[model samples]
Target: MGEFAKRHQSPWPIIVCFALNFSKVVALLSPIDFLFYLFAGFTLAAGVGVITARNPVYSVFFLIAAFLNAAALFLLAGAEFLAFILIIVYLGAVAVLFLFVVMMLDINLATVRAGFVRYLPIAAVVGGIFAAQLIIMLLIWQQSETPPTLNALGNSPMNQPNNVYALGRVLYTDYFVAFQTAGIILLIAMIGAIVLTLRPRAGIKTQVISQQVSRKSSQSVRLVDLKLGQTHPTTAATAPTEPQEGSA
Candidate 1:
């Protein structure tokens, strides 16, 4: 309690949270947990910096830091599988791929800035809609102070008749056909839309009506007349090759 009191005065209690959790490592309060909390805050700050950086390369670095911090938080929450997955899938793999792609893609700031004036109106409308949605969500959320928690009921309808797993079970199993049908409908609509907008572009290879109409078999082929002339033979290896032994 004294350690916490000292921490509260500094306006930074992450170290306190880390120390409190770390002290429980030996089946008791782990003192080192305060460090993890502090680290998590730094990671979040780095992630924000990365997103705001003008250079895509710097942003990728910040993204990596954020994923690492998120994984740390997951571990603190007792989710080892999720924590490792977050690090491996996001930090180890996806971040590197994004870094490589960003490095390769050439982005001209001048070209991008040129379109700002023309797109300002559309951008403003979209931004306004997003702001409105955010305000509505915040207002609805602020109406309640208590944090949401799931009731661990065994006989939940989302699961089996008397079981409780997750709401996803019925969604994936019972509604899988609907999902597939929706996918096929989207595919057909996409194909139809593509066909609707297709235009025969100029200078493309195609059969010409004029060429076909003017074509004639006689013009395409001719039998050339040649005068018969006697010519001396060069040489003969075997006039008629020794007759294959009596095979007349």
Candidate 2:
């Protein structure tokens, strides 16, 4: 059994050697290999911590660290603009907002788990679909062979770099309209989400913005004071005139 398992899983040394070979190619092309390694290592550690941390605060902190490291890696990958945007937009804004929301929320673990049994079937179906799709993809990819390299094209990948640079240029120039359209679609989605969250309830009353602005305070407030205490002259025992009439 041990021998079969060993055959199934490659030795640690082989895996290490394969990793070194892969990193060597990247390091050869990469100008700042040390920076990339540090960033990549930090990202990996942070990612693990984010998922495994018991405390939500620690998880959020780990996630932020991961995002920062990922941004650094993105910058190293030659997407400096995108890297900065990720830091500014996602890390700075989204992470902090989520962190605050997480801190503010008091989760009822028991109540939340009440539906787990009911939803298990649906969850299983979704999981099965995902697994099936993934297996199919792996089978297809395994069966497909690599395309033959054209010797006429440069042997070095640097000579004909991946579509990153060309894609960026086209995105900013020729496909700018399409990019804006995509942005608009995202904007619409955001608005739709906001609308969905703004559900009207029978017991809850909400004032219209236009009506609220036009509302007068005079109509809402009126001065009406009432006096409850009355003179108790007859009920008092210190009445001299009543005593004289009783004696006569």
**lDDT per model vs. reference:** 0.62, 0.68
TM-score of each: 0.39, 0.49
lDDT by residue for model 2 (1-248), tens: 11222242433553465477966655543346556667878999998998577677788999999999999887666666668888999888999998998789875546756898999999999989999999899779747643324223333222245535544555676568999999999999999999999887788777689976875655343333434775444334455333322221
Superposed Cα deviation of residue 164, candidate 2 (Å): 12
Roughly what TM-score does model 1 have, to 2 decimal places?
0.39
lDDT tens readout by residue for model 1, 1-248: 12432344443344455456744533432344454546667787987787477777887888888888888776554455667878998877889899998889986656866898899999999989999999899678637443122233332232233222333344356566887799899899989989999987988898799977996645443333444773323113333323223221
In model 1, which range of ten residues has the least summed lDDT? 147-156
Residue 182 in model 2: lDDT? 100
Task: Supply the global lDDT for candidate 1.
Answer: 0.62
Candidate 2 backbone clash number: 0
Best by lDDT: 2
Candidate 1: residue 228 Cα off by (Å): 40
